[model samples]
Target: MSGLLCYCRGGFEPELAAELGERAAAAGHAGYAVTERGSGFVRFLTPAGDAAGLSRALPWRSLVFARQKLRLLADLDAVDTRDRIAPVLAALQAGAVDGTLAPRFGALLVEHPDSDEARPLAGLARALGNALRPALRKAGLLAAKDDPRRPRLHVCLLAGDHLLLALGDPADSAPWPMGVPRLRLHPDAPSRSALKLEEAFLTLLDDGERARLLRPGMTAADLGAAPGGWTWVLQRAGLQVSSVDNGPLRQHVLDGGGVEHLREDGFRWQPPRPLDWMVCDMVEQPRRVASRMATWFREGWCRQAVFNLKLPMKKRWLETSLCLDIFGREAGLPLELRARQLYHDREEITVLAIPTGR
Candidate 1:
């Protein structure tokens, strides 16, 4: 029943624990150890009941089968450079180097006596990639040269003898790939903040889920609407948005009839009529934002909401718990709520909640 758990972000334990509960499809915790800040090796009760199935289900490349004994494999002095990494390349060729086996988007923990030894590790990864490219093509895990676009696969380089790779099956690929090489890595890319948070948000959204959250002709209020990122998202979904903030929004966002700009204090302002949606990204204490969200829900001022709660300097898990509890107690409505440290966010968690009825 003991296995490893890998999380996003570096050095935040409470956030990782909160993520585990939020991702409730998994099993209970037995014990866990932080391998690195954002990532960890854990021994937990396997939800799958079978060891092999659990191993297959979890993102193992980012996570390793540490079993119940949380031991660190730090015998760097004895490591065989070439031999240690061969099996990992073989797994990548076989298309077995999945996110669970190797995290395609997390950090690797490595220690070298000097920078000289670390150079080989970097060289080895490049050499392995050279070997993997042709093999992946032969396996049909990669697209043929004639294909209009070469599918950009997700990859992670770990410190140990492992290569984490996520093959982008053509049918399931994103409309536009993010995070991988050759794709223009935008400075404002949403999924770049924390891998786990991005994963959680994507996991929560499907075509149906997104459609359910958005409705045509719905009136929306967006707090902290400067530069109009969230408002941009809502307007694209065909909702009419009143973007509220003292700061100016992007001229294009305001030019459209779908969006209106209002220079006002979001906390103090109230809509003349109940809004269909309320979204906020204000930089404030999480509890205050949670209380305000609860008020909107309880007062029937908004039927559904999405907002970001900025976590404190420490104890992020405690803050998330407190916010959730506050909402549950104060909202006084049947609610379906979800929170994740989104890929688009930094030092804050995004929450979505909907009342039971339309």
Candidate 2:
């Protein structure tokens, strides 16, 4: 059976593999993932009889580590250096796709992994997509423009002469490569780190959730908020923030009047009332931070939370799984949880937990 291809950040292939494997098993179709460190991808192999239906059963919103998920249709070997395009087109045309998806391809995305060795191929991927799109359309395989109702074709370059072809539902796939939201640092924000929260909002939460949860004038607190990076993000969202830290926040953040800088320990500080949201970017053990964030939900201190978990150098996937499991048990709520290794994040992953009804 063919496998599901997952695009992820470099150096966290193990984490993505573990997550996909567990999610697939939990969904009643047990499977395993093949992964390599620093490769920026994982492939979860489907059961021999289950490949056709596996994608329909997997919940896109529940996945944390995978940026994009596609069912692999072809794995071409020994690609001709001078005539790769013809084989690629042939492979795609011959590939097994859903009977319903046979004629409707809304978009074509050519990409490579985000590893150090693979970085140079980005330009090549772009060039290939440019050349391939018209050919596909001419062959009646691709639609002229992006149609939300149709699926997307994914061509991933493996090496100079190897490649993988896959297909994804646009409704479930990442709009951008590796599921990373392209965000720019606001010039007026206290620090570039603000982009993390911005990206988190755009990626982790859907538009409906954001519209309802992040309304202007919502209250928030930023823990360990020195330099006011995350605080600046909250401010821009129109949340009056209590920036808690021992070190001083950026002067501009303090002067903004929407934020109240408190020289206090984030661990000990408590909001005067239940707030709308809480965001933490503190540098601490992944488990400890997860526990703290979970406690806030358990105690009903905040309605929602977005926090960072600083991972260790080894066994990161195991450690993160344990932490999230503990948080789920401790929170004891019907919670909607999502986590991702964002482009702006280094040595950490961001988590968003919202109490759906509890």
Candidate 3:
């Protein structure tokens, strides 16, 4: 059976596999997931249907654990390093094209899992990627000029000399390697928590929405804002922030003068007036946080929000699904929501919600 391959954070093979298996089953392509511990990846094998078609059928946004999704096209075992590019090129020419779309690949991405054995292949990918692209072009497998709309070809080096070659729809797969960006922390930010919001913006919103929605002078509230990590992120984005927490904020955050320190409980506090945005990173049951976030939108307390939900030790995917479902119901009609396991989060996931209408 052909399979779908997904890249995720190390040690989360179980969550990624379970979520993919469940989602694949729900999509009418029942499958089983397999991965090794600390492998940093998972594969869902479907007994029926073409893998590319199955990948297209799955909703990319609904997946919480998967970072990059690829449709398995070929698997090369015991690659010859002396002339590694030759075998890979032969496989691509023969079978890597998307059967469903007769797709012409725009780019070739040579990737590897985050395992220690796979990390060394970064150099191999860099060396062979340049070699294989031209070989593909020479063989008429790729166009002379790239078309951004076309799918990307992926060649993933496994722990050994083996490799898994795949194709991914540009619309359905992450545009970045391992679905993570290398972002530097703001030197002046109060805490490292600021990275979550930065990544959320880059991953969740488009360029136009970001420019229009995050303009200077917009007002925001940061709940559980002690140490003011999220608040600093908001202020850096040029919003006036109300930092609500019983504990004091970092001295620099208070000294910045864009923040109003409020000694109040996040669960019970309300802004004196409606604000443009709200952010939360409190440690609490995901359900309680989701319910509160929904209430903020349901009553028009804020136009949009980015928050974190701490998950229990088990059934994290299921708990996340159920909580988001509850959030959707409580938020009512015309609401948009997205949740992701960011590189900066641990035992928690971040959520972004926007109300489309009344």
Tell me each candidate's TM-score: 0.63, 0.94, 0.92
lDDT of 3 by residue, 178-288 (tens): 666788998998889888899888877777879988989999999999899899888888899999999989998888778999999988898778999999999988999
Off by over 4 Å in 2: 47-49, 98-101
Per-residue alpha-carbon lDDT of candidate 2 for residues 1-358, written as tens digits (9 for 90 to 100)? 5768888888888888877777777778867888788998888887664665677667566676777878777777799878778887786666456423355588888888878878899988988889889988988889988876787888888887888888877777787865566777778888888889998999888889889999988999899999899998888788999999999888888787799998999977888899999999998888888888888888888999999988898877788788888888888788978887777888788999887652
Ten residues in sequence with the least summed lDDT for candidate 3: 94-103
lDDT of 1 by residue, 1-358 (tens): 2333332434454456444434334543233333434342222334333433343443322121111111121112233456644443455444342223322311222211112323346555566556655655655455444242432443334454443333332333222222211222334422232232233334435567666767788899988777777776677668999888998877767776698888999887778889988988788888999998899988888988877788888877777788988987999999877665544456777777876543
Each prediction's whole-model lDDT (CA): 0.54, 0.82, 0.82
Better of 1 and 3 by TM-score: 3
RMSD of 3: 2.3
- True lDDT of residue 257, candidate 1: 67
- Model 2: ten consecutive residues of lowest lDDT: 95-104
Best by TM-score: 2
Q: What is the Cα-based TM-score of model 3?
A: 0.92
